[model samples]
Target: MKQVLVLGAHGQIAQIVTKNLLAEDVQQKLFLRSSARLTVANPQKEKLIEGNALSLFDLQQAMEGVDIVYANLAGNVVESAKNVIAAMKAKGVKRLIWISTLGIYDEVPGEYGKWNHEQLDGGYLETYAEAAQLIEDSDLDYTIIRPAWLDNQDEVSYELTRKGEAFKGTEVSRKSIADLVTKIIGEPSLYVRESLGVNKPNTDGNKPAWYR
Candidate 1:
């Protein structure tokens, strides 16, 4: 069984990913900033490790004996990604599955996309894009999955495309993103070093229904 370490185990996407990981038969290690903030009950508690994703010390501690690192960290994406890369390098962890957003590429051409760009002119998505660029230039084995407009729906169906291509959809379910993350963990060779945008298929106005 592969020993996997997950960062940002408390966020919405992280929570879904954590649930799926725990249900699997693999050995999973969760790294969180605080245990008090986690309200989810894990019957198998031994796999969970509490640690801050932003702290080098905590990251180093969590990186030990891990085969892959699944980073879903939030806030200051550029700085956080830098720290994560450093920690992974120090511990000789070779695989990273990074969670990013679709608007980072500015490919979604329309009023909504324009609004999104305006809103994130100086926000986390900009930082996320910078971090993604760093990952693109790094030597580490990485796959960046950028999902569009996440929703709380229950389904896990979606389509994926390469960078610079329009997503054509929006508001993918959190469950689908989690499924994608799990799929990456299981099959790292499929899209290594490639950044892909994921979304539901568009059925109207050449754009996906979710976007409308």
Candidate 2:
């Protein structure tokens, strides 16, 4: 079984990814600052390692013997990403699946894009942008998954786009992002070193309806 380490295991997307990985019968080690609020009813199937995403020492410990690293950490993205990269370097781990947000590239346009900018003011989005750049510059084989506005409703289904193209939609479900992560884990070669945007297809409006 492949040993996978997931950072930010308490978040919505992370939670869904955890469940999907378990369903795949993969051995998962979750690293979080606090696991008390995480109600994973099945303890026997998954391993929980309590640790902060900012702590390199904690991350190093959690990454031991892990084959893949899935990072879903939020806030101070650059710092946290640096820590993850450092840990991966020390452990000689090569593959990483990073969860980033859309608009990091200013690819989402118009009114919805304006709203996104407002929501991510004070350079929060820039932080993620810098983190993505770091991943691009790193030697590790990395797949950056940038998803559209996140929603909690329904199942996994969405469209994906490569860099330079606009991510033409809105509100992908957390479950859908989780499904993408699971798929990436199983097929690591599919998106290596690629930064892709994921969104639900928009069939209305002159432009992508979902973006507006």
Candidate 3:
């Protein structure tokens, strides 16, 4: 069974992924900044480790005896990615699945693209892009997921754009992101060393639906 280590396990997307992990026959290690924040019932089934993703010592401890690392980390993400990469290398872990955003690539088209840069350029988009670069340059087998603006919808419907293509649509359900992560965990070879853009099918508009 694949022993999976989840970084930033408390985030919305990671929480959904954590719930799904319980159903799989895999050993899960959840790494969070504080142990008190973990509220999952029957939590004994999974290993819960408290640590900062940016701390090499913390990450190294969390990554021990792991096979795949699912990084749901944010905030100073480029530095976080660097720390993760270093820790993974130290542990000799091979696969990494990282969450990124679509606008980082400037792949959202026309007015939407303009709006994306205007809103996120100096903020999330910049750091996310740098983080992607760090992961892409690393030797570890990796899949960087760039999802459109996220929502709390219940279903898993979604679509994708390969690297270099304009990202389609404006928003995707958080559940959709979780489902994709589950799929990748089940089949580690799928999309190795690739960065993918995900969105809901036919949802493309001048901007996100909520913006209208």
For candidate 2, lDDT tens digit of each residue in 5-85?
A: 989989888888887777775788888888776776467668888998888899999999998999999877898999999
Model 3, span 1-212: residue lDDT tens: 77999999989999999899888877888889987898765555587888898899999988888999999998989889999999999999989999999887777899888887887887789999999999999999999999988999899999989899999998999999999999999889999999999999998887788864
TM-score of each: 0.89, 0.91, 0.97
Q: What value does the lDDT take at residue 206 in candidate 2?
A: 32
The local lDDT score (0 to 100) that residue 70 gets in candidate 3 is 97
Candidate 2: segments with Cα more than 4 A from true spot: 203-212
Candidate 1 pairs with clashing backbones: 202-208
Ranking by TM-score: 3, 2, 1
Best by lDDT: 3
Model 1, residue 33: C-alpha shift (Å): 1.1
lDDT of 1 by residue, 43-74 (tens): 45336678876788888888899888888888
State each model's CA lDDT, in order.
Answer: 0.79, 0.84, 0.90
- What ranges in model 3 sit over 4 Å off? none
